[model samples]
Target: MYDVDTRKRALALVAQGRSLNSVSKEMGISRHAITNWLSRLEPLPRTPPCVRCLESPGIPEDTAAYAYLLGLYLGDGYIISKPKQHYLMITCTASWPGLVDAAEEAMRKVLPWPSVNRLQRAGCVDVKSYTRHWVCLLPQHGPGKKHERPIALEPWQQAIVDAHPWEFIRGLIHSDGCRITNWTTRMVAGERKRYEYPRYLFSNKSDDIRKLFTDALDTVGVEWSTLARGSDPFNISVARKASVALMDAHVGPKY
Candidate 1:
């Protein structure tokens, strides 16, 4: 077995952009040994949060709908696992019943055999589905706010997003975003006048999630602004009329 210092030196040499073979030759170690060490240094395999989530898989990795569900899951979804069973829950504000319905439909399209239900809590509705494939779809599943910890997309997930960016944005915004009217007053001909305009706002407490939201918007050519409302959740808004219209064409109100 290679000593820790030897392994560290090999990795550091690679970090300086040296070839594995050259590093091995200089260190009098085999090139295969360096290659094996590099492989061992990679991230641990992301296992399912729950073993049961792997039993009966539904949903393939490449579908647009599946990608949409993934965006939704990253934004507002969570998974619960008990021995022998597991459930995927995408929580939405009670006010957005249509969004909840849409989430249900998406899940149904992906998992035909599982029944989807809406569970109403005090101020929210959970679009819940019993599925064993939830963890397989979202290996990033973990406890606490997504931004509080590191968040990243797997290669397959990124590929799906590259192909279906709009659908993924739709899922993200519909779940945590809103198209609301912004009202303002101004002096018109020396008199105060009121006017209203509509914009889209995607809010979340997680900075990482917010970045993901903005990145998706950029990919789709939608212009937006981000704001932190005095300790309130940070949000990105597309307030320009042209940009708002563009977003409306893609991801407007769920209802």
Candidate 2:
């Protein structure tokens, strides 16, 4: 076993961005031994049971049962889980052709009511089709009147939104759909401007559903702008693109 001083030193090295392998080597300890010591030294804190469990009678028991079912679905859904993973789970069901509706309904039923509202206020559910499979994503909320800047996306969510297009394109030539692509910073009139909102783009082949999509965008008060004209000559599909531009362009850029 390593001494307390050695453990503290190793932790400090890790805080300074030193690799675990390098830290173990520097401390004259085996990497596996260091990993074991670290795991034993501090275990991750467990999530507390939902507050509803204590406040509402009977609801907790039902919620728990639903959560268990949800966990099973998550384990067997498009994504799988690990043997050692432990987390609270919840499940909901929707019709086959209505995946987006199902996801929203499931989320409403499974999550605490407050959480559902928070998710909706942040951004609505987005549905995308790739390689014949429908993928739906619930976006995070943007900055509001109280907040000076837009909220940042979680790393996992950001990765999914960023990489999905490339992954889809690589898999099939005809695969195209709406995607949230970039978060960019720009300069306007010698002032630095930060735009933290997610940008949505519709591919050329999405013409079939453009009207349906545009109506939804209008309902959300999201204004669309044309970034480019015409379709890719090689693709021979009319690619009409639109963007939200900024979450709070009305607020203007902060100096």
Candidate 3:
């Protein structure tokens, strides 16, 4: 059992905006313990007002985080906003604990007052934040599958994406993209030598969403091409050495 001082320090770190996962790792304390401490001391409260609902509605203060979340939402995330239920859910693979933590942290940064939780499934974890104002922030939430509908960013969101292109790219990569290396053996003089080609691939069936991703790539000067299998163009690939370098510096591989 942790002492009073330990609990205080953990809460203090959380108050300073550190994530529960990070705090738990640092203090060697389980997140359940820290959560129990918070629940005992903090009172149940109403959900906080969304910034977009203010008299003078404005974009989220942390535009970079918002842009990143937007990319993730468009990639594989979704929002549910029934009368009694409202939340944003981003699914991260269970294997990537760091990515799951990062997803929850981004949710908190974009909307600090929401209650964020994780739902673990067979091979993935859904990082969800409960709030009714998700619709206010993510206007793209709609009734059908994302691929069947038009996906266009509002001017304000576009501005944010333009400003923080790398974060947006990182979120997209983390959600629906991957970095891989392909190697082939070739004859060098009399010996067979192996060479590796590293590339980044983003696969999505939605035309509009793919356009948005490629447009962002264009803005960031990352050379990419549509990779086709047989007759279907279904993936975007960054195979050029310089473009791969740029993507590595910005997005890297998911944890």
Score candidate 3 by lDDT.
0.87
Mark the regions of model 3 whose C-alpha exceeds 4 Å error after superposition. Answer: 1-45, 190-192
Q: Give lDDT tens digits, candidate 2, residues 191-227.
A: 9887654444443332323333343344444565445
TM-score, every prediction: 0.71, 0.23, 0.81
C-alpha RMSD values across all candidates: 17.3, 18.4, 7.1
lDDT of each: 0.76, 0.34, 0.87
Which predicted model would earn the best TM-score? 3
lDDT of 1: 0.76
Off by over 4 Å in 1: 1-62, 231-233
lDDT of candidate 3 over 1-255, digit per residue (tens): 888889887776565344677578878999999999988966334455788888988989898999899988998799887654577899999999989998998999999976677888999999988777888999988999998999889898999999999999888889999999978899999999999999999988899888999999999999999999888787999999999999989999888
Give candidate 2 misplaced runs (Cα > 4 Å): 1-31, 34-81, 84-216, 223-255
Q: Please report the candidate that would top lDDT against the real structure.
A: 3
